[model samples]
Target chain A: MDLSALGSCVSQVSCVVTQTTSGLISGMLLFLVSCGLTLIFGVLGVVNFAHGSLYMLGAFFAYTVYVPTHSFALAILAGAVGTGLFGIVFERFFISRVYGSDVLMQLLVCYAFVLILDDVVKMVWGASYLSMGMPEAFMVPPLFIAGGVVPPFYLFLIGISALFGLALWLLMARTRFGKVVRAAAQNGDMVAALGIRTPYVFAAVFALGSVMAGAAGALAAPVRSLTAGMGFSVLIESFIVTVIGGMGSIVGALVASILLGLIQSFGAIGFPLFTDGLMFTFMAVVLIVKPTGLFGQRVR
Target chain B: MQAKGTIRHGVSRRAALKGAGALTLASGIGGFPHIAKAAGKVIRVGMNTILSGRVALVGTSSSNAARLVIDKFNAEGGAGGRTIELVVRDSKGRPDEAARVVRDLMDVEGCEIILDSEASSGAFAVHEVMRTRGVLCIHTNSETSQLTADPKMHIPTVFRSARQGIQDAVGGGQYAAAIAKKKKLTRWMTCSPDYVYGRDNTAQFMEYAKIFDPAIRLVEGAWPKLFQPDYTPVITKILQEKPQALYSALWGGDLSAFIDQGNLYGLFHNIDTFAVNLGDYSVLKAVKSLPKGLHSGSRYNRIVPHSAANEAFYTAYTKRFPGQWPTNWSWQNATGAAFMCDALKKTGGKTDGKLLAAAIAGRTIKSPFGVKGTITMRAEDHTIIDYAVAYGITEPVDPYLTDIQMADWGAILEHEAEWKKKKGYA
Candidate 1:
């Protein structure tokens, strides 16, 4: 091969690697948010429309905590715990009442929560964009990988998401509590008949999901602008991820999020204007091809 | 003339006095307006603004500034001894909502004059209502050039106190062109919101920048969705393209977010960032830290005008709000209020829309920041002319701009008439 041809091939390979890295970072962020949505659906049998609001609250909590403490880690912890407690309260007061009701009724209840939480956020934060300064650690020089330089924060995000994913996997698969939760997800009536106290399990799952969303928000606070509308933007993307991955499927969400992220990362470079349209198109094709989604189980 | 002591609308003089007293108490004036009301009757002015949702900061600051001006007027016996009462309606950043609320302000609220501080789309909506209803309207914050530059959209009773997008673009482009020439910066790219204002501003800036420096070449244009929370991909792409300079029209939260994320990728270190909206205090405040020497223009910074009146408004605004910086819209709306008061005084407190509009037209108002000593309300298009067109580098603290470069409006507006004619707007 000619020297120029070899150079071009090397360049192409570098481009692919950079785009893939970009995709992974974005996908991991989406997975962090979507896992919570899917987990809630799996255990509670209710799609929490206010899940995005919980995520937004996490960022705001991080900001509020970060300002006084100046500790990003502490802020993240506070955000997660705060949102988890709020989720518990939300489930107890609102979701618990609408349990075993029609899907539309449950949706309305969650939608009401969405509006309430949105206003609550606006009232607290004011209707302006807020941002967190990047921590000193993430502000270091980018690590050169292959031909492209990667921001250290992106790697930090990826590492944290992977750890969380593993921890969640172990919790759901390895523990006795996990077994009961899984059983409740499959057959809540049967689990209740067996005296499992399914409400507690459901609430626990919802809290866990809310915590994950909060973590995602806290993690993304430095990366994305904190706005009242941030919740809605991420909500739509998470919904797409949950749907594409198969609702209530954690592994499915993980895979779908990465796939969507890769599509977005590449689509942004190839067709910037149609990147959003590309995502919806992918979702439409998935739904048409497999009504149960890629990893979604068929209901008996 | 109607007799003062005689009964009108089935209310006796004594009863009317009692009702007015009850209203004065109910409205919570707290006796401050007692003296002003005794001097003359109140004149109601309605404000249609985006008081809620994402862009509420703009509306809130503008409304606050207008209130400050109105309060000052009321204290000084108001316009021709008529106390000005500002009734505000939230437009919610929607055109249809703006029209509806403006109609309600005019009809139900019994407002004689309207000041709209909405975005361009909402401003156009309110403009239609104002034209149909024959209410004198002063636009405070909308910057779409077509709202005033296009003769077809002109109405006798409508005048824009806000600077036009074309004027900003022309001035900003010239400013950037000079820097690009001097610094040997050639390659250029644009990253603006995917909307009318963004697209038009970017296009106009590039078109005029090339006119100033024909050597400059635009390598790429990225129009991110409006209010897009994440700008990582856009930032990365810009870095990869490696433009010598970039023109960005992103503002508010979006701009702040972009700045935050872009800083991570060292985007500013690589490119000469010429953002039209970076001079805005709201966006500047939102950004965690201002990168030194980021080039921008069009939005107001208190020091850029360097006039006693500008300093006084800035001082009063900051004192009133406490720790809050005055935004571009704050001064624009305050100027609008001042102009309205001046026009009302000229008209002897007559609320006749056309007469007041005529009085304002072709007249120059003494503004703290304007070319040729004052800002003139152009008789032809009813848009304010010769407003200050200055660019400056970003600084760390309050007064965000330094090393200011002022532009001649005559040079900036030289081709406006010809260009409008070419576009068949004349």
Candidate 2:
């Protein structure tokens, strides 16, 4: 190619690389939302339709707590912990009875939960958009990495998601409690016969899922505006990510999130009209070919 | 099951007998009672709009605007000294709710006229009922081009205050497209809120642009879901495509969100030129920052220098609602309300639905936009010829507002006759 054309090509390639980085950041947020959803679906064997509501609550919590406290750290703490507590109440009071019910019956119950949570949100926040931001202290100069200028906070997100994934891996692989939980997931009666409190473990897992979802929402508030309908979009995206990442796989979520994020960012630059369609296309390809997803295991 | 069925049958039979006896008594007493009740009774006006969700801003503002006019009319004594009682219902911006709410308003309240069915769907639903009932329906903000113009779209007894979309596009488009060309951005992309109004506006603008300059290619278009809070993905995509100009038809919460997010990401700063087709003061106010030369337009700018009507309306509106500057749309809505009131006054408070509709469609009404001139509702299609201007955000002010510099206004309305000649049965 001529020198000017070569220069143009180089510029285009650099732009593509920048867009890819953005996609990764987008994917990380998706992963955070999906990870909890997949976990709840995996262990509970019931789709929590109110999962999006929990995500929205997480964001609102972050906004109210963090904005007043002026501390990002406190916001995450309050959001995650608060959502976790709320999740426990939900499980004990509402979800506990539907343990081994038909999918249709579980759906009806969860749909009711969705309605209740939506109403609760309306009552709490009223019907208006709320704008929020991260603490000023968390603001860092844009990080220049991978030929793109990304918010330093996004780098922090990458590190946090990875570290959280590692910590989760260690807990699941190395702890006795983790083993019992796994056994319960495999055979609840067997674990119960072994004198393990399976129901309590189930409750803990649900709470854990809630905390994860809330943390994701808290982290997301800074990047996106807070709205009542925000949860619905995340809910659908999270479902897609979960199904694509293998319905029950944590590592798969991390990988799939990054993959989807990259696709979104880069794809957006190249095809503004088609960017939303890209992630769905990826999931369709994965499902059509592997059915169980890239990281999903077959049911016994 | 047998016992319950038998009990229900017995009760139903007893109820039927009672109903029959009551019917006999109602028939015996009907005509005289009806005549007595109908005399000097208040004529109900059913007003429905989406009073919730993202478009609540529009709904609330419209309700208040209509109420302001209604209050003024009542003070002068209502139509024919028959009090025009307005019963408002929230449609929730959904057609089903609109149909349901409108039906309730009509059946339960005994409303004679339907005023300002806010959204396109709600307006259409109420128009259907009004057409069948021969009730007068006046649309304020619904500028869905075909609702009045398209013969196929059956909405009888419905007349629009807002100009047809085709006229609006011609008025806004010609000026905007010329500015885009002058700014060295011949190629354009449209990012409209994905709905009927957005789609029609964008389509009409594009059609105008194509007619204006055949060379102008629509490079890329994006229609994100209406009232979507985030546009980073779509905005980023559009920026990457490097279109010369962006025409946005997003309004209300969507526009607010777009401005907030777009300003943060320097979306406009990166682009050579951007235009919000209906970007009014409300959306512009919410933005913490605006691109220095960003082109935007509103139906009316409060800052329009040297206008007697505007000055008077501005003074009145500000005096009433302190600290909150009224938007261009607020003025337009007020104008609509005023027109309806004026029409009723001309007829000496007569509640004749046909006369009210005719007076509005054919008569010139005073508004803040200009000197009182006839709306000149074309007999071909019921769409009115109204005023619209395009401007650019020139500077920012402390009241969370920006000064808009007027651009070409004449060229925009040059082909009004052609647009009027274009016929449809909407």
Candidate 3:
């Protein structure tokens, strides 16, 4: 190739790289959120529509903690632990009653919680948008990746997401609890026959899933404006990610999250007007072509 | 239908029941009971707007302003001793819901006038309802140009008290054009919501900007979905394009996210950003650090009008609702209520829609937000005129906007006429 053409080609490649990196930044955050939805749906056998609200609560809880302590670590901890406890309580009282009921009944319960949670948020936060500025640790300058600039916090998210993924794998594969959880997923009756307290297992799984969502929200707090119903958009995106990744699959969520991130980044660039529908379109195609997601187990 | 034998207080039960039934039938036959109750006593003014969801503040401010005006009017012996009773309903930011709620206010609640405080999305729907209902409506929150500028969409009973996109575009365009000329900035990109108001506002701003300065070119336009939480990708594209300047119509949480994210990416540091909707208290208070040197046209800044009446009203609003500043909707709604009151007063408390419309047509009234201490309800089109539209550089401190520059109404109207002509709008 001629020198000028080669220079242009290199620039184009660099542009692609930059956009991809940007996609990965959001991709990592989505994975953090969607994995929890997948986990909760898998083990709980109930679609947790209130996962988004949990995420919102996580961010607000973090905000509550952060305002007083101003420690990012404490805030994140408060987000995770607070949401985890909230999930336990909700599951123990409301969700547990409708565990084996109709999906619509469960959905109604969740919808009720959604409305109540939104009201509660308004009551506490006063219905105004809030900002918990990036933590001191994350207050670094933008990093250049392949001739494009990006926030360093985004890179931090990617690293943290990777670490979380690893820890999740270890917990699910290396531990006896993971074995029992997997057994419960395969056949809860058999796990019960094997003398396992299936209820405790379900509660633990819900709490764990909620912790994931809380961490994601805490991570996302800096990147987003904390509004009354801010969890909604995250919920929609997480739903999309969960569906595409095959609900209940950690590996699938990670892969699908990145794919979605890239699609959104590229789709926004190419088809700005249809960008809103792009993710739904992707999900529709996936549901049509393969109801069982990439990493999900095929039903008999 | 009454029993033959019954007694209470010197009357049989049958007789009392018969008497009650006759009275009810007579009242029903003579006139609706509601009308009888309303006659010379109360003028129920209906209002419908988003009262729930993300933009509830719009409804809150609009409702509060109307309350402020209505309380004063009622206290002053409202329009010939008929008190103005506001019957407000929440639309939940849904267009169809807004229409339904407005209808309920009119039909179910016996409201005569509609004070539509919906955003553009729901306002248009509410507009259609009022067109058929034929009740005088003063749109208090919508800023979409076609809501007023398009003669095709214009209804006799529907008038706008809020600023229109064309008005702000001309003003903001001229203001930004001057800045661009001084700085010799040519490349421009827009980051606006991907909706009617956003697209129309951005297009108008760009058109007027080009009219004012032919040297500028639109490099790119980023249209994010309304209430879009993440502005990362859009911000990335803008940064990559490296436009010399930018404009955005994104407001509320969307605008806050854009500003905060843009700051992180150094998007504003390099680009001369002019987000017109950035002047709201929501955005001003929400942003992490109010970035310096950002230029925005006034939406609702207390210091812009520089009038005693405006300051007094601001004081009144703050006093009424402490710690919460009145938004742009507050002044517009207050203006709308005042206009309705003035018309009612002119007609000596008549609720006749046509008469009230005639009273307000081309009438200039004292306003807290007016440039010259008065705002005119333009006769040719039922929109506003001579409001204190301006632009200024932003600061990080109180009076967050500095060096406030008011836009010329003459220029705005002149350009607005040209724009209408271009759009084939009467």
Candidate 1, residue B38: Cα displacement in angstroms equals: 16
lDDT of 2 by residue, B363-416 (tens): 566555642332444445555554545455645553222555443435544565
The alpha-carbon RMSD over the true interface for every model, in angstroms, is 1.8, 3.4, 1.8
Q: List the residue pairs that clash in candidate 2.
A: A23-A261, A23-A262, A27-A261, B79-B349, B80-B349, B149-B426, B150-B425, B150-B426, B151-B425, B151-B426
Q: What is the DockQ score of candidate 3, to 2 decimals? A: 0.54
Q: Each model's C-alpha lDDT?
A: 0.84, 0.67, 0.84
Worst 10 residues of 2 chain B by lDDT: B30-39
| Per-prediction DockQ | 0.56, 0.28, 0.54
Give a tens-digit lDDT track for model 2, residues A1-300.
Answer: 123422442377545554665666677777777888777777777677778878888888998897667788888788788999999998988888888888788888877877776666656775545556544654444544554445566667667766656776676678997787677778888999988888898898889888888888887776555666568877887888888889878878888888877766655554445656878899999999999989999843
Give the per-residue lDDT of model 1 (tens digit) for A260-279.
88877667667778889989
Which predicted model would earn the best DockQ?
A: 1
Candidate 3 lDDT, B196-307, residue by residue in tens: 7888889989988998999999977888888888888888777667799999989888888888777777778888999898887767877877789999878888887987
Model 2 interface DockQ:
0.28
User: Which parts of model 2 are misplaced by more than 4 Å?
Assistant: A1-11, A66-70, A133-153, A189-196, A269-278, B1-40, B151-156, B209-217, B227-230, B273-293, B299-333, B369-381, B394-413, B420-426
Which candidate, 1 or 2, has the higher lDDT? 1
lDDT of 1 by residue, B1-426 (tens): 578896657767888899998877754443333233323478888898998888888888989999998998899887666889999889889999999998877666667789998988989888888777667899999889888887778888889999888888788888988999999899999999998888999999999899899999998888899988777767766766789999999988888888888887777987899988999888887787678889978477777678787788788888998867777888789878888988888888877888899889898888876755588888898888777889999987877888989987777778676678778887
Q: Which of candidates 1 and 2 is the stronger one according to TM-score?
A: 1
Query: What is model 3's native contact fraction?
Result: 0.51
Candidate 1, Cα interface RMSD:
1.8
